[model samples]
Each structure stands twice: as C-alpha cells, then as structure tokens.
Target: MKVIKEISLLREALRDKRKDGSTVGFVPTMGFLHEGHQSLLKRAREENDIVVLSVFVNPIQFGPNEDFETYPRDIERDEQAAYEAGVDFIFYPSVEEMYPHKAGVSLIVNSRTNVLCGAKRPGHFDGVVTVLTKLFNIIQPDQAYFGLKDAQQVAVIDSLIRDFNIPVELVPVNTVREEDGLAKSSRNVFLSEEERQQAPAIFKSLQKARALIDSGERNPEKVIAGIKEELDSSTSGEIDYAELLSYPELERVEEIQGKIIIALAVKFSRARLIDNIIVEI
Candidate 1:
C-alpha cells in the first residue's frame, strides 16, 4: 500500500488509480485503527478496485474541551493496518493542507444535528459534516464506507449527500464490537480497568432496549427509562442522553410504530461512548 501525506501527492495517487479504470472506495477515519476500521476496509476492497483510507484525526470534529490533542494517532501503525486491510493508498493529510484558508462557510444538516450525540456535544456534527464534505470532495470515491456504530453520524452524512446532491454512494457497514460486546472505538483506550469492565453495559442496555421494543413496548418513555434503568443499576457510568427516534430521518419519537433508532451515549469515568440499535416495530 502507498502512504501519501501530502494532499497533492495523494490526489496524484488517486488519479493514477482512476486512470487505470479502478473504482475508488474511501474510508475516512481518525487514527487508532482496530478491527472495526479494518472491517470497513475489507468491505471496500471486496467492492472497489482501489481503496483509499484516510487517517487524519480531524480537529474540527472535536470540541474545545474534547480530546483533540490527546486523540490517539500513530501513522506508521495505521499505514501497516491499512496495507493489511487491502488499502491501496493512505490519505494522511495535515491540518494546514486540509484548511489552507479560513473556513468561511461550513456544511450542516439541520434538525438531524440536535439530538443524542449532538445534544450533548453541540456543533459536533457540523464539524463532522464539514470535514467529511472536504474528504468526499477530495477523494471523490465511487463508494464511501462508514461504520453503523455511529448511527447519527451516518444519518447526517446521508442527509448531506441528498441535500447537496453529492454523487457518491454512501455505504453503512455493521457495527463491530469487542468479544465482550463493547463497541470498538479509538477512545476505548481511555477506559480504566474497572471502566473497561463496565463499558459493555452500554451495549447490554441497548440490547435490552431492542428486546423491549421487539416485545411490543412502543412507548418511547418506557423504552428509554428501561435503558437508563439498566445503566443506573449495573454501572456507575453517567448517562449522557438516551432516546428512541425515527430511523434515518432521526426525529425524536414518542411512540415507535415502524422503524425507529434506539440510541444512547454514556460517560464512564474516562471517556464518553455512544451506541444505538435500529429496529422495525
């Protein structure tokens, strides 16, 4: 696999692949790659002729108090993982290269940006949309792969594609998790030993929520309370926000009828984590 840190060099690499009749598949990620990221790459390789995985820990997506500087990164290790995952090029661009001029304007998908993760971390998805728009513009991939672990982020990106008419296929891959059921994330490293043990409760709580919905529990308050109750009883983790919302569109729902997304964000002693389950009721 080729690693190109310079934006021009990366574009040149992509151009070569495009000229050779290769369909580009892009996986945008902050570094600290794990099996979850690898799964996205593997899927990309299966469908596309060339896979470009970007490893820029976008500063904009992080809040002022968030862990922008401490976000884990090791380009060498990331490049190796990318190579093993069948990536053709690693687009590792610097902040300066990404934003040479001031960001005079930004892309935002409204309504979709005000719940769950967005409610807790204001302006988070705006940064996500902006950086993702930049990456999509640069890579111009035939298909872009994103993990379903971040369901809200997936929704926001899809909205951007529709609202802006960006001509690239957006693919949502399944959420990858640890053996113990905790969702794999770069921030998982922040968990202390006890927090790591309690972290899986987030997933367990979501699973229970799904079970309740599957059992014909449609009242949003009941479903949400059950989830919160699980977290309250079994863990010391702080509840950030828990809600059941309409799938894809993400509008908050009082009663789930057809398809709805049950999502939650919880903070352990260390870092905040988010998870969701989409179900048909």
Candidate 2:
C-alpha cells in the first residue's frame, strides 16, 4: 500500500482519487495494529472503492499523566497489517505536521463529555474531537469507521457530526473481542499473566448486566448493582466506574427505557480496560 506522511501529499492523492470517482473510506487509529483495528479497516475496504488508514499517535488526545509518550507504536508492523487488510493509503503524519501552530479556538464539546471516561479523564474528549476534526477534514472521506469498544467516543463523534454538519458518514463497528470475551486493546500487553486471566470478568459483568436488563429489569441502580456484584466477586481489579446511562447522549436515566449502555472501566495492576454492551429496551 502507498504511505503518505505529508498532509499536502495525502490531500493531493485523495483529490486524484475523487477525480476518478472513487469513494474513500477512512479509519483513524494510533498505531500498534491488532485484529480489532484490522476489523475496522477490512469493513471499510469492503464498503468503499478506496480505503485510507491513518496511524498517528495524537498527542493532544492524551492527558498529562496519561501514557502518551509510552503509548505503543510499530509503524512497520502496522503498514503490513494495513496492506493485508486492503488499505489503499496510509496517512502517517508527524505531530508537527498535524498541528503546526497553537490553536486559536477549541471544539466546544457537548455535555456528553461530563461522564464515563470523560468524567475520569478531563479534556480527553476535547482532544479527541479536535484531532478527529482535523483527520476528517484531511481525508474528506465518504465514510469513517470507529469501533464500539469506545462507545462513548462514538457517541461524542456522532454528536459532533450532527451539530457541525460534517459530511462524512460515521460507521460504528461492533467491538472485537478475544475468545474469553475480554475486549481487544493495545494496553492488554501491560496486563500480567494473572491480570490477563482475570480481565475477561469485565466483559462477563457486562454480559450479566445485559441479561438482567433483558429479563425485565427496568431500574438502572439494580442493573448497575448486578454488574458491580459480578465484578466484585470475580475479579481482583479495582472498579473505575460501572454505570447504566442513556445511549449516545449518556445522560442519567431514572428508568431503563429506549436505548441504554451498560459500561464499565476496571484498573488492573497495569492495564486499565473498558467494555460495554448497548441494549434496546
């Protein structure tokens, strides 16, 4: 596959593709390619005439104490995986290339940023929206793919697209998981042998919560309690947050109705893992 590092070069390449009446599908990712990322790229490849995958570790999306500097990177491996997944182009831009000067204004995020991972990591989604805005503009694809593993992130991007009238279609792909049910993540490498064995409890608890909701449980507190009980009994990891909230908007709901998300984040010894299940009630 062709790799373009400069912004202008990538834009020119895309312009040429558009002139040929090819539809572009974009998959934005930080490197350390895995099956989960490839799943998005494969789907994008199937849907669009030209598929573009970006491998930039967006520094702005990371917090001060976060693992920005230490976040994983393997461009050579990522390129091979992208090529196998049928990617047409790889946009591997540097931080300087992405942000040459200090931003004069920021994307005003909606109230959805006040809960879940957002509540724990302040300004995280702001960085996410800002970087995504830049990527969307650069690629100008007909469709963009994101995994449901970051359901809240998908929700925020959905809101951003609707509010800002971004032309690209936001395609939400289902979360890819291991045989044991733990959501696949780059941070999984940090999990100790013991921690890896226990990590599946996160997804197990989410499944329990989904079962409880499907079995006529309408109270949000009760559903959350069921999930927490499972996590407490099964895993040694510390619970970050186990919540049941409105889907997409993430607002607190008194009763479980319409659509809702049962989300959780657990801090193991080394890795912080997150998982969720979206249910229509």
Candidate 3:
C-alpha cells in the first residue's frame, strides 16, 4: 500500500486511477484504529475496486477546549490495520498541508448544528463539513463509508452531499460494538476501569428507548425521560443529552411515526460516550 502525504500527489494519483474507471472507496478518519474503523475498512474492501483510508487528525473539527492535541495517533499501527484490510492508499496529510493558509471562506452548517452534540459545540459541524468538502474534492472517491456511531454526522453528511451535488455515494455502516453492547470507540480507552463496566448501560438505555417505541410509546418526552432514568440508575456518568428526534433531519417530533433516532451522550470522568438506536416507527 502507498502512503500519500501530499494533496497534489493524491489528486494526480486519483486522476490517473479514474481514467481506468476504478471504483474508489474512501474512509476518512482521525487515526486511532479500533473495531469501529476496522468495520468500515472491511466493508470498503468487500465492495470497492480500490480503498483509500485517510488518517489525518483534522484540527478544524476540534473545539477550543477539545482533545485535538491529545487525540490519539499511531500511524504505524494504523498502517498495519489498513494494509490488512486491503487499503490501497493512505492519505495521511499534515495540518499545514491541509490548511496552508488562514481560511478565505468556511463552510457553515446552518441546519443540524443546533441539536445534540452539535448544540453544545457550536461550529463543530462547520469544521466537519469543511474538512469533508476538502477530502471529498481531493479524493473524489466513488463512495465513502462512515460508521453510524455518530448518526448525527451521517445525517449532516447526507445533507452535505445533496446540497453541494458532490458525486459520491454515502454508505452508513452500523456501529461496531463490544460483546456486552458497549459501542466500540477509540475514546473507550480513556474510561476508567469502573467507568468501563458501566459504559454498556449507554447502549442499554438506547435499547430501552427502542423497546418503549416498539411497545407503542410515541411521546418524545416520555421516551427521552425513560432513557435518562435508565442511564441515571445504572451509570456513574452524567447525562449530556438524551434526545428523540427525526432521523437525519434531527428535529423534534410530536409523536414517533417515521424514521427516528434515540441518541444520547454521557460524560464520564475522562471520556464522553455517545450511542444511539435508529428505528422506523
């Protein structure tokens, strides 16, 4: 596998590859290889002619108080994982290469930035959309893969692709989980031993929300309350937000009738974990 660190080189390589109609599958990641990332790579390997995995830790997507500096990185480990997963190219660019100058214009996410995690971190999605636009333009892959662990990001990307008419397919992979139902995350490492034991309850509460919806509970308030109660009783973490909203659109619903997401974030001692279950009702 080739490791590309320059934008022009990647662009040239992709342009040449496109001449032969090679189908490219791109997985953009802030490099900390885990089961969740492996799942994306595995699926991309299975379905595409060529797979490209990017390992840039995007500086823009992080907030002033976020973990951008300390966010994990081990390119050697990621390289082995990507090679094993059949990745053909690894576009691992530096921040300086990605942002050579101060931004002339930035992509502002007007919608989908006012709820859940987005609500708390203003302009987070703007950074996300901007970086994605750059990657999408640079790689120009035939399809891109993203895990549904951050389903809200999936929703925003859906809008990004449509609104800009970017020629790429958005493939949403299911969240990879541990044996006991804890959603696999790189941040899982930061969890203290005790917090790790209680982390499974995050997914459990999501399941409880699903059960409520399945058993004919349509009131958003009640469903969210039930989810909060489950988290409160079972975990040591503080609940960040437990919301029930229309999927993708992420707007509040009077009654759960269509595709909806029951999502939550919990702030543990050292890590904040997020999980969700999407269901069609």
- Give per-model CA RMSD: 1.1, 0.8, 0.8
Residues 1-281 of candidate 1: C-alpha lDDT, one tens digit per residue: 88887877877778877997889999999988998898999999999999999988888788899989988888888878888888988888889988889977876657777888887678888888898888988889999999999999899898899888998999999999999899999888989988898889999999998888778887999988999999998888899899888988889776788888888888887688888888986
TM-score per candidate, chains pooled = 0.97, 0.98, 0.98
User: Candidate 3, overall lDDT?
Assistant: 0.92
Q: Candidate 2 residues 88-141, lDDT tens each?
A: 999999999999999999986767888889999988899999999999999999
What would the per-residue lDDT of candidate 3 be over residues 179-248, giving only the tens digit for each residue? 9999999899999999999999999988988898889998999998998899999999999998888988
Candidate closer to the true structure by TM-score (higher is better), 1 or 2 = 2
Off by over 4 Å in 3: none
Q: Model 3, 58: alpha-carbon shift in Å?
A: 0.7
Model with the higher TM-score, candidate 1 or 3? 3
lDDT (C-alpha) at residue 42 in model 2: 87
